[model samples]
Target: NQFKAMMDSANKYNVKVIVDVLPNHTAIDHTAVLPALDEAVGGHDKLYHANGFTPIKDYNDRYQCTTGEMGGLPDVNTENPDFQHYYMTYVNDLLSLGVRGFRYDTAKHIGLPSDPLDSLAARNNFWDVATGREEVKGLRLAVPADSLFIYGEVLQDKNVKESEYAEYMDLTASAYGHALRTVLDKADFNADSLLNWHHPVDGKHLVTWVESHDTYANEHESAGLTDEQIRMGWVFLTARQNGTPLFFSRPAGSTRENYWGNNRVGARGNDEFKHPEVVAVNKFRRSMSGQPETIATADNGAVIVVSRGNAGAAIINLSSEPRNINGVDTTLPDGDYTDAVYGSSFKVNSGKLSGQLDPLTSYLLYR
Candidate 1:
């Protein structure tokens, strides 16, 4: 009934809802956990770490990463063929229920088939076994082949690599957030750094976000950027040329719990789409989809003009003082234009645009 209601709302809004799943670990009291415990090693491949794999001693050991328990939750042995088929059954059920997309949580913990560190090499890669071409072909027999979309929560740092999972699906560009926070702290939210973020994979294969559920509850890292500053950050994220942008909506007036963190949802708020800038920029993004960016930077990199394939241009100001964005190559016809967000008017002269960008504000200009 809950899923039906959700589907109803999704249909009403003409949107597709993606569900997040924890494929790596399960609760301590899960049904499969107890049964696996009593079964002899290798007797029941459904058990946790059922391959008779020993404990991983080194923190960075590849074997340990794949087989180790994540925080205390019993980790599933994705390498087990029985387990692979078992998990796919659940996925197939969800597919039958009209689930169009999936978000694989903690995907890095699962082992790749034929890992150099694994003592056993026969285990099939979890994704390949569960959702690769063969599995997807079977799924397509039941539904449209292009209907199912999947992305993984493969967070990348110095140790974790995103290229490993590039074959399966897009990955979350976690570094995009960290890098934005860095420049926002320095009071120079330059778009160049973000546009040229050094990631192992190309921008097309990544999903970017300004913040997530976890970041909101943890104040130390993002608290430096105030709510207004955060909104400014959003302009940088959504107005950019590459990668899909995700907008995370947190409860209003919510703070981190002292010990538990943001473990629970706070008071529900409708502030996410209520802001005028967000509304206008979202419309511009839709209109400018698939457009290449022509960047023009000025004011010592404090101001930028992102021209989107001649469809429109986004003029952004990163500093606190209002400055005139002069001689910006918007690539728009020489005519009058209005800022979609602020309603400020400007005239294009000789294929160039000049306007006074308000302090820490953005202007979406369209013909």
Candidate 2:
């Protein structure tokens, strides 16, 4: 029933749909494979990569190294032919289903080269190659080419280098860029002189975000900021330009658990389309913003806004209070622009414009 409902729900919308391919390991009880325990590991060859070690207490060994989180879940060895055969078949199933792309969860831990491939290597990296072109080519009988938009979940990098994950996928987002939460925590919320990390998106791939389904749902979640701060953050995350946008779904909160929904804004009290905070954010984002665009930064420090063809803009304030967006001395043509605080409204003027946004709120301008 659930699968049928999902398939039905998918057909109801014309937008492309995707599935998350978690590579690090299978869930503790996932039926994808059987216990490498008593069986000969048949019927699910790609699910296990024999490391040539018996007793095999766990699947993380030479062929498959675990991500250190111990449990019943066994990891797959991307380098193992047996595992490749298993996984490629799985990938083919989805492509045949007309699914648009894939979002790889924890792609870093599964590949054979755990040594951290360089930028050049990451770009040239290909799952199709590792699985063998012949295997991929043969799949033409089942899956079509140019059928997937693959990306990954790379949580953190202590070094803070952009180029590392930049070369690897078509679209990527970060849980690290929490402008929404940051602004909510601020007292003044000045976006001026704030260095917003939004520009590198349109021309290159970017997966930018604040929270996700996995984000904290307990009352203690949005630390350091106020409700208002988180609200503004949602304004930016949804409506910002470049890269694909992700909706955060936390089941246990005010209707809008994440940016994709309205737990933050409370549907502007009326719960209709125009009043709530996020509705304003959502409409603007949908109208504008596509991949392969770049951001415009006033300098490295004061203010930075990510934009894609004036479709959407995320203006952030890096300070404790409201910051003024100065370098943006230019005014946009008059039209209905979406405000993070206020819902959609026509831009009253075209002169150098400045508005006082809370610390955590990002003002989106959509024409």
TM, every model: 0.84, 0.62
lDDT of 1 at 186: 57
> In candidate 2, how many Å is residue 48 off?
4.2
Q: How close to the true structure is residue 139 of candidate 2, measured as C-alpha lDDT?
A: 37
Candidate closest to the true structure, highest TM-score: 1
lDDT of 2 by residue, 88-166 (tens): 6766666556666778776544443334332212322235543234463243224443445656665443332334444
Displacement of residue 58 (Cα, Å) in model 2 is 18
Candidate 1 pairs with clashing backbones: none
lDDT of 1 by residue, 45-76 (tens): 45566432444455355567777766566666
Q: Output the worst ten-in-a-row residue range by lDDT, candidate 1.
A: 136-145
Score each candidate by Cα lDDT: 0.69, 0.47
Q: How many times do residue backbones clash in model 2?
A: 35
